[model samples]
Every structure is written in structure tokens, then in C-alpha cells.
Target: MASIARRPDGKWRARYRDDDGKQHAKHFDRKGDAQKWLNEVTAAVVTGTYVDPNAGRLTLRDFYLEWKTRQVWAPTTLRAMDTAIRCCTFADTDLAKLRRSHVEQWVKTMTATLAASTIRTRVNNVRSVLRAAIRDRIIATDPSEAVTLPRQRRTEHAMRIPTPEQVGQVLTAAEDWFAPFVALAAFAGLRIGEASAVQVRDIDFLRRTLHVQRQVQNGPTGVEVSAPKYGSERKVYLPDALVTLLAQHIERVGVHGDDGWLFPGVPTSPRNMRRAFDRTCERVGLDLIPHDLRHFYASGLIAAGCDVVTVQRALGHAKATTTLNTYGHLWPTAEDRTRVAAADLMSTALDARGDQLGTAEG
Candidate 1:
């Protein structure tokens, strides 16, 4: 129920009871203004888009903080989201007053200093907060719903996949203890964090497999063990050479127990690992990071005729699409397969005819 009445002070008061029976009132200088405000409220109610006048009083930052507590995001992701929210220009703006223009302006500001991917991450983080606000009825629509983002420039040349020869040189240049760690990434396709978390028992020498269970990540409380990215826990088969190398390293280093880390100490720290890897690459006269080894491993799988699903599983990707998107260029095209098949058919027919002629002549 809503009403407009003139008060003794000559001010027109508009009051209404919301869906929950809570009364909201506002005073205007003229009766038409009060009636117009009431009509808008009524129309909003009829359209089922009614947002309580007080609900949107919370600032974007306040809403983000509230929404953040309920997320099950990993510590790294939480840190990233926190950074993104903190960098928002409209962080102090009330959610009720936030418009698409504000979000667009934020994107424009970020594009000036941030990379395309970084800008997208920041924008997506804010978009998620606004979506939660909508679900909570703090706002009727997402301010970021129509905001434009910079295009992510990803091409085949963007990803650096180190050559097998270069990888071998780097592995050979590595110290005895570090060679096994390098092999796991280049041969077994484990991320540096996953490699750091590998236990002695996680390796099955007989089965020639490595079970990825967790990853060592930088959490809110410093270095901690957590589930793999996107929970991509799976077994990756090891090459015979890598299996032998790991066995020898384990024997020489001596693990404390079944739960002992495969490459303990400095190798587990991603920063230290990168430094060591950089040193090894310098010695081999190649420029590469440890992550480039993973690309090498994926490329090898594609060359060996592994399908998208097989490569995805080997690389511990959460989705087959992720595998295809990253390594699609490496896979053979349908035309290549067709040409190979046609050539093989022609060669077989020619060989058979020659054999028949030899038999008749005999």
C-alpha cells in the first residue's frame, strides 16, 4: 500500500509498504513529484523488479567483502580477487547508484595500465560481486553486465614450447638433485606446484605412474598444500627414463617416509625453482621457464597421435576444451590424415601388384 499526502510543512510525503510489509517514506516539495515516485515504485513491484530502498546502501567494497566469505576459492584466487576488488575505482560507490557507465569507465581506466588478461580478471571479479548482489536483491541488475573488455591476444606464437633438444640440454645442465624435478615437468607434464607436492608413495615404479593428489601453493598463511588447480587430480604415466631417474634420486636423497616429498627443500619454492631453472637454461644457452617444459610435454603428446581427451588427462587439464584451446595448432589436421591414408592405400596396391607379377613369372 502506498499514499501521497501534504503535510503541515507544505511538503508532499510519499510512503509505501514493501513486499515484506516494511514502510519506506520520502518527502518531496510538490504533490506531482511525490505521486510520480509512488508510481515508479508501483511499476517496479508489478514488474517484479522491486529492490528495497535501503538494501542498496552498501558500497561495492562492502558487498564484495560480504560475498567473498562464502566463496570456496583457493588462496591464490582469493588473493587475486582481493587485489582486483581493491583496485576498483568505484569500490566506495553505493551499489544502488552504480550504473553501467561506472563499470565501463573502470574498464577504460584499467586498460590504460593493465594487460588485457589482467583487465579481464579485474572486470570479471567485479562482475561476480555485482551478480551476487543481484541474487541477494541488493541490486536489480549487474552494472558490469554490458561493459566492454579488451580482447585477449592469444596466437600460436604467444606460447613458447621449448624444443626437445633444448629441454635435454637444460636437464643435463641441472644439478643431480634438480634433474629429477626437471624431468617430471618435461616428461610427466606436472606443474611446478604439483611436482613440489609429489610424495615418495605417489610414484608407482612398477606401474610407471605418478598420482597427482595436491599442490603446494602460496596461501594466505604462506606456503601450504591444497588441492590442484580446478581439482585436477589424476595419474600421469611416466616414461621409462624418468622412472629410472626418479628411483635413483630417491635412493640417493633418501625419503623420510612414504609421505616424504620427492624434491624437498628449495626446489619446492616456486621462486627458487624458477631461479634454478633460469640458471640451467642460461648454461644451455636457451631462454625458457619451467612452465615451457609442460608445453613441450603437451606438444610431444600431440605429435605422438594422442587425442584431445588423452592429452587433457595427461596434462591434468580440467576440461578437454582447455587442452584443445592451448594445443590445437599442434594437432594434425583432417587433411593431413586423409592424405596419409590415400598414400598408404596407393603404396599397398602397387606392392601387391609387384608381388603377383613376381609369382606369375616364377
Candidate 2:
């Protein structure tokens, strides 16, 4: 049974014992308020949903720190989360007391200072923390769930994919050592990180395949080799021309052992090839980023009538939806194909009908 009494300080006090015989107490200014709280606590206990009041007293910062330590995030993800936590405004707010309005206001403030995508990411980070809090029974509901975010516009100019002819030009303009790197990105559709982490052994020349198992990322501490994004380790097929070019590249680089990096820089490290790629692009009069080469590869696959699953696999996308979302515009419209097929069928039927009528008349 729960009990309520007026304290000497003129505040009403409520006390209750949980199923485990753990006593809990809360003070309120009015007896009715104390009774209400006690009743809620008793109901929760009866429903086996009782959460210790003290568990949620910790500030958001405190809970996040505790939660962060238990998570195994990738290096880039860890850096992003750290940045989000540092930039969040409600670090001092109690986890239990945090309200939807507080999250909405935070989103508003963030919108004023950050890009739409960035604000969305940071808000997601906060939401992740709150979600953990809910799972731990520190809070009953997520405050960030109902918060509205700004829309992100997709611009065609965001990605500049070079044509096949332009790709050839860029490859020709690149230096001997750098040509292979460009080819890997444009042909094999490897991310820059995945390309950098490639070992000679990872390529099977006879099989004409490139295996992507890992990636190189530069984090706050330093360069680190980690799993590929979304754990999308996949094998991408290579054309005969690309395979021959890769063989020539290996010979030119004098890679004696299979363990050596396909594109090595300093002793036991991969080269940073961004500047070289940029210089080559400028020389060839093409406005392109290293990632645009990947887009070019996907475009080629799509143009060749590759299905969404094939394109997704070739690009090492974790989800087919991701491939569609990025390159859906490049796919041939089913409506257009349907119209053409319908016309051909109608024409054939009319010709057959006319021949039958002429034969019957004869």
C-alpha cells in the first residue's frame, strides 16, 4: 500500500514500496499531487512497468557518455557522434525531464546555424541517445520523434559524372601511377576509401574480379583501416580491358608480393590521391570529383540495362533502395517501353487482319 503525509516543511510527501520491497518517496507542494504520483507509481508497479525514479535523474550528457562507451561505432561514425554530442544544446537537461518542445527548439536553433542535412544528422544523433534512454526505461517516450526537419533538395549539379569518352580522356591525362586508381573508381565503382585499401591479392586477374573487403579512413586520431561502409564487402567484375590495364599497372609499380597495396605510398601506407585526381581532372578540362567516377561507373551499368540488384551489387550498396535513390533517374522508364511495345503489337495485328481480309476477298 502507498502512503501520503504532510511533511514538517509544509510539503506533501508520498511513499510506496515496490514489488521487490524497495521504498521510494517523492515530495509535492499539494496533497493531491502527491496522491496522483503515488497512484501512478503503484499502477506502474502492478503492471510490471515500474522504473526507478533515480535512474533518469542523470543529465543527457551523463547518459550519452555512458551509452557511447558501450557502442561499437566506425571511426567516421564515432567522429560524427562526438561532434553531435559536443554541439547539442541540451547537454545539461535531465534525460527524464526533456520534452518534445525542447527538441523542437533545438532543431530550430540548429537550423539557423547548420545546413539541412547536417541538422538532420545531428538531430538523429540526439534521437539515438534518447532512444537508448527509452530502451533502458529512463524515459517512456522519444521527444525527437515528432520534430520536423528541413527538406533536402536534390540538384543535378551536385554530382558530375563524366561520359565514357571523357573518362577515356581523363585516364589518358592521368600519370602512369595514377591511371590505375582512376580506372578502379570509374570501372570497378569502388569508393575512394575502398580503393585505397585494396591489396594486390584482393584482385583476381584470371577471374576478372575485384574484391572489396576493407576501407581506409582518416579519423581524429589518425589513419585507420576499417570495414567497408555498411559492411558491404562485395566482388565487382572487371572488363577485359580493365584487367589488362591492372596487369600492366602491377608490372609498372614492381609489386613483388601479393600483400603489398595495389597503390602504395610511404612504407606500409596508402597514398592520398585526391590532389592527383583533381589535377588530372583540371588538365582534361573535366569538372569532376573522385566520387563522380563512381557515379560514372553506376551510370554505365544502368545504361547497359543492368537491373537494380546488379547495380546495387556492383556499387557495393548495402540496399537496392540506395542504388535506386541515387541513380533512379538514369534508369529507362517502364512507361516509355510499354508504349513502344504496345505500338509494335497493334501494327502487327493490323497487318495480319488486312492479309486475312484480302485472302478471303480473293
Candidate 3:
């Protein structure tokens, strides 16, 4: 309930009790101003957009600290969220007073040095914090909601896909221990982390397949073994050549049991893997990372007439749209196929018509 009353000091007092039974009051010079304030509060309550008058005094960082504990983020995601929170410059600003200009300015500052996608992630992180505050009834609206963000380019053009020859050269030039690592990425389309976590038991020589179940990830603390990326746990078919290579690699490394790591003695971390991969690239005179090999594998699939869903499953992408977003350009255009099909049909019909006309004339 809300009411406007004339105070003993010749001022008007507008008072209301919130849903929680706590009362709030504002002193105004005129009775009209007091009633207007009550009307606004009553409308906000009716519309289910009411916020506690004093709750929004907490800063963004304060809310983030409380909000983070409730999130069930994966290790990589946790690290990324922490990074975004730390990087947010307006974390000290009060949620109620935080304006869209503040978010826009923060985005503008990031545009100078950060990529569009990176900036977008950071902005989204801050926005999530604001959205939580809204849900908690600390703020009425999200300041970051309407702020403009930098545009991210389509991945198909941005991704660097290495050629088959370059992939072969890298595989050949890689050191004995690292060759299998490169092969898994280039041939099987495993992420560096997933490849690093591959154990002997995960490989099936008879079926020529690799099971992806776990990954080595870098969390806030350090490197840790964890489940593969969401929807990334899958079985990937191996080519006969790749299967033979793995068998030889296992024998050479003296790996016997299912529990044995494929790259024994090497740290199962992306940093170590990248270091080894960089060395191999230098030896082969190619400028490429292990991830480029994954692109190489995906491009090979697309070139061999694999559909979007087929490539998505092969690469263990969580969604087919992710596959299409990154490699859609590699797929042949439907319009091109349609035009060819129409031309062939028209040509056959015309040829038959010409033969009939010639026979009639004869």
C-alpha cells in the first residue's frame, strides 16, 4: 500500500511498503509531487517491474561476486567469465545509476585493441551481471541491453584452413612423439585438448575409430582433466592410414594398456602441445597452429562432399549451425547445383525434340 500524507513540518510524505513488508518513504515539497511518486511506484508494482529503492546501491562487482557463486560454469567458461569480470571497467558503478553510456564507452575503449568477438563476449558477461540484478529486483532495467557492440565477421572467411600438402608436410616434419598429436588434429578433427587427453583405450584399431570422452583444460587454478566440451563427446571414424599410424605410434611409444596415454611423458596441456606444434611448423617452414590442422580436416570433409550435419558430427561440434557458420563457404552452393541440373534436363529435352523433327522431315 502507498499513501501521500501532509507531514507536521509542512512537507508532503509519500510512503509505500514493498512486497517484503519493508516500508520506504520520500519527502516532497508539494502534495502533487508526493502523489506522483506513489503513482509511479504503484504502476511499477502492478507491472511486476518494481525494484527495491535501496537495493540498487550495490555496485556491479559486488553483485558479480554473489552471482558467480550460483553459476555452474565449466572450467574454461569459468576462466573466461572471470577474465571478463576483471576486465570490466565500470564494475564499481552502482547498478541503479549505471547508464547505457557507461557500457557504450567501455565497448568503445575495447574496440581499439580487442577483436569484435572478444569484445562481444566481455560485453555479454557484463550484461549477464546486469540481468541478474534485474531479476533480484535491484535494478529496474539493464543498462547494457541497448548498448551497441562491434560486429563479428563470419568465421568461414576468418578461419585459416591449411592445404592437404601442408598438413602432410607438418605431419612428416613433426618429431616422433608429436606426429600422432598432429595426426589426431589434422586427420580426426580433435581439438588440441581432446587430442591431448586421448588414451590407448579410447582408440579402437579393429573398428578404426577414436572415442572422445575427456579433455585437458586450463582452469583458474591450472591444467586439469575434465569432460570434453558440451556435446563434444563422440566417436570419430578413422581412415585406414590414420589407424595404421596410431598403431605404429603405440608400438613405438611402448604403450600397451588402455590406460596408457597416447603421448606419454608429454604434458597433456594445450600450451605444451602448441609449443611442440610450433616447433614442427618451423621445421616444415609452415606458419600454422594445431587448430589450423582441424580446419584442414574439416575442409577435407567438405571437399569430399560431406553434408553440414556429417561435418558437424565428424568435428564434434555442439550444433550443425556451428559447422555451417565456420565452413559454410566451403560447401558448394545449392543455386549452382540447381542451375547445372536445369541445364542438363533442358539439353536432353532439346536433343530429343531435334531428333523427332529430323525424323518427321525425312
Candidate 4:
């Protein structure tokens, strides 16, 4: 049964009941609004397709635990998700009673303070959480869906892709020991995690390629070597310049057999943060993220006039569309492509449609 009645606060409230013998009530600002809600609820209840918006009352901490356990992501990824969840206003609230207003306010506050990419990531994370809730049948409606997120502000820093000349200069400035490593990242576009775990044996000098089988990451348990970041483990082709650099670096540093790390930490560790990479960036004067080298690799490929599909393959992306979406903006327009424009395709169509005849008449 369903009906609308005025509450003590002088607002209309829709009252209903679930099959499990529990009363459900939803408040509205107006009587008509309450009646509309009651109509929808009663119609749904009659058809047995009604989804109780407040069916399972669980806390945010409960869902967080559920979400966290279900994630098969890397530890670093888990930590980031946990941190993002903590930053939410509902971090300590009941997930079952989570409101759209709370999410909107959070987005607004964060958008005013945080970077666009950061805000986007937070929105995505919240979406992920609500998606899981819906999948679990815990919630009938996703509150995150109603929330309006901020537009991604295209800042100069966001669009400023690293040029090859700048990349070469930065790598060149690195010390001899770190030079080859930096060059590898700049040229090959391997993530720092992948580069750090690269074994000496992974480099097939004769083949002119490096096998990217795993990655090194920092965790509470210390440095751990795990599979590639995207988990699409694949080999990276070495440019002639980088290949030559690697060959020389191997000979100079003396590779410790196949098991030894190519970019091994100085004190014979998988990750030697105490030396090699640390302070090297500070020394070099490049105010860039370590992972930006991957961008440098993608940007260079785009700049060299390589096809987006091939670049996607070289980067081992799961999809060519992914590569196109991320780095397509950095690609320069080709004169050859202009020759095959939509206008050219429309040439015959325009002629067939008598547009040519109209042009002559005009």
C-alpha cells in the first residue's frame, strides 16, 4: 500500500511497505511530488518489479570493505583507492543512506580546490563504488549517476607534451650509470615500475628488443616485482640509439647474468632508491613526473608521424582506441590526410545531388 500525508515539518511524505514486512517512507517538498513518487512506487509494487531504494541498509565502511576485498588490483592501486574513499564525505557515513547532494557537494568542493584530472579520478572512483553497489543489488538507483561532475579543465600542464629534443636533453644530462636507464624510459616509454624491474637477461641485444615481463613497486612489504602495470606483458622494441646505449651500458656496468636487474639498485638490490634514480631528477632540473617519460615515448611516436594503431601496439595497450584517446590530442595534422577530407568524399555526392548544377546557376 502507498499514500501521501503531511509530515510534522509541513512536507509531504510518501509511505509504503516492503514484502519483508517493513515500512518505507520517502519525503518530498510538495504534495504532487509525493503523489507522483507514490504512484510510481505503487505501480512498481503491483508488478513485483519495484526496487526498494532503501532495501539493504549498510554503512560506507561495510561497502568499502566489500569493494576493497573484491579488487584484484595492485597494492599501490588499492592504497590509492582506499585513500580516495577516505577523502569522501561519506567516508564515515552509512552507504545505504548516501545521498546525491552529498556527492554533488563533494564534487563541487573538490573541483574548486583540486586539479581536473584529480577531480575526474575521484569521480571515477565514486562511480566505481556505486557501480559495485548496483551490481551487488544493494541499491536500486545509483546516486552517483545524479551527481554532476566538473568539466576537465584543459590546463597548459595537461596539454604540454614533452618533445623529443627535451627528452634527449634530460636523458643526456643524467649520469652515465643512470643515462641508459633514463634513455630507456624516454625512448621505450616503459613505466618506472617496469624499468626498475627489468632484468639483464630481458635485453636481447641481438634482437634489439627488451622483454617487459614484470614491474617493481614499493609497498609496506618492501620492493616487490609484479607483472606489468596494465598486465598486458609484452616486449618493447629498442630504437637504434637506445639499443646502442644499452649494449655499452651492459659492457660498462657488467651484467650479473640473466637474473640480474638491468636497472638494479646500486647496492645489489632490485630497487636501490638510496642511489641511482633518487635525487637524479632533482639534479637534472626537469620538473616532471617520473611516469611522464612514458608520455615522452608516446609523444615522440606521435611526433615521428607514426600511425596511432602501431603506436598503440608498441605501447602494449589493450586497445588501439585507448592510445588514440589518451595521446591523440598530441598528434600533429598531416598534409597528406588533408587531401582525403570529407569534402573530397562528398565531391561525387555533391555532383549526384545537383549541387554542382546549382553552383553553375548561381
Best by TM-score: 3
Tens digits of per-residue lDDT, candidate 1, 3-28, equal 99899999999999997889999999
Residue pairs with colliding backbones in model 1 are none
Q: Which tens-of-lDDT digit does each residue in 1-362 have in candidate 3?
A: 88888989999999999998999999999999899999999999999999998998999999998899999888788778778889888888888789988888899999999999999998888788888889889999988887888987778667898888888899889888889999999999999999988898899999999999999866556678889898999999999999999989888865633568887543366778889999989987988988898998999998898989999999999999988888888888989789989999999999999999999999
By lDDT, the candidates rank as 3, 1, 2, 4
- Deviation of model 3 at 322, angstroms: 2.1
Q: Give the C-alpha miss distance for residue 328 in model 3, angstroms.
A: 2.4
Clashes in model 4: which pairs?
60-95
In the range 1-362, model 2's lDDT, one tens digit per residue, is 78999989999989987666788888899999998898788777677567777777998999988889999887788889888888888878988788888888888888887899899999998889988888887877788887889888773545678888989999999998778889999999988888877888888998999889998876556668888998489998999999999899888875534567776652123336777888998997888888989999999998888999999998988899888889888887889789989999999999999999999999
Cα TM-score of candidate 2: 0.84
Q: Model 1: how far is 199 from its true place, Å?
A: 1.7
TM-score of candidate 1 on Cα atoms, chains taken together? 0.86
TM-score of each: 0.86, 0.84, 0.90, 0.73
Per-model CA lDDT versus the true structure:
0.87, 0.84, 0.88, 0.73
* Residue 70 alpha-carbon offset, candidate 3, angstroms: 1.5
Error in Å for residue 303 of model 3: 2.9
